[model samples]
Target: MNIIDKTDEELLAIGTPWWEDLIKYSNKGQYGKFIQNFSTDLLRGLNEVEVGNQFAKSDLTRSLDTNYDFLGFIRRGEHVSFLFRVRSTKKPGEWLGRMVLGYERGEVKIFAASIF
Candidate 1:
């Protein structure tokens, strides 16, 4: 289903703290979710790799970016763990550390993130 048509229950099931209503209206495209949640550098890296897949009409890249091998998720109370890596294509093998997103009270806030 399209973003506008998705039910609140379905959005809540995804387990992010940002309320469905807040997310749905904040950006025209849900693709911006990544940009909204991540840092400028990270977003840039993602853009370079086409992580949001703006060129393609699909959620495949966004989903993968959020839940990848190195990047995983875990639900702990009000917080949903987010884990992911960032590496520059130009740098090749040079990779960055994992990051996490803390969710609480309908807000998907970054609790503690670092370059691991």
Candidate 2:
């Protein structure tokens, strides 16, 4: 019931919207919409506003830059992760983020998102 039937490239392709949505929601301050995209395990029933604030920073929201690219991935048995390199043109800064997505309960769910 795993959701990783597609190739590595395909898996990466599926995550593009996730990355975009993160930046978009952060900028818009739509806490509800943002956390809704996360897996139930990620939220753990915590207050969605706090979780959204934890994921986004005020600096990131101030910048109009929203460009990111996939650098590569790491595969360790069932653990598959991809690193995205994000750039802020307004401030001329860069940040790398790592997102892990895998199958749980016959579905592909995002497990974690951390700064790389």
Candidate 3:
């Protein structure tokens, strides 16, 4: 099924596991596992050194509070951008987390992910 055609609940179901893996691997500083489901374009723009640097320097990327609140999503073209109200396990404020999902070579993959 096309990702963009899925309902909100379905999209959440599809994205939740990937999102969880992202948080889990990120907290562990496992760069490979963290980008396992990333799209080609995303992978092309990232590298272990860059990710490691971010993980080392950014508190938001170091350890995220797993109890994130889903802040709905926006569909644009072939992608669905999911937003979450996230917090840092080591910090004390809310941040916005975004994950954009779409099909790549017939498989669902993350085109982008960020915390701000």
**Candidate closest to the true structure, highest TM-score:** 3
Which residue segments of model 2 deviate by more than 4 Å? 1-5, 45-49, 52-57, 61-64
For model 3, how does the per-residue alpha-carbon lDDT over 1-116 read when each residue is reduced to its tens digit?
56779988889889998888888888888888898999999999987687899978877787798899989899999999999998888899998999999999999999999988
Worst 10 residues of 3 by lDDT: 54-63
Rank order (by TM-score, best first): 3, 2, 1
The lDDT values for all models are: 0.39, 0.67, 0.89
lDDT of 1 by residue, 1-116 (tens): 12223344543454344332222422234454534555344444554445334425433221222212344555555444444454332233423333444433444444433333
Q: What are the per-residue Cα lDDT tens digits for candidate 2 across 6-82? A: 67778867777876776677667776665555677887857766665664665655353566778887766565687
Off by over 4 Å in 1: 1-70, 94-97, 104-106
RMSD of each: 11.8, 2.8, 1.2
Instruction: For each candidate, give its TM-score against the true structure.
Output: 0.31, 0.75, 0.93
Can you tell me which runs of candidate 3 are displaced by over 4 Å? none
Models ranked on lDDT: 3, 2, 1
Return whichever of 2 and 3 wins on lDDT: 3
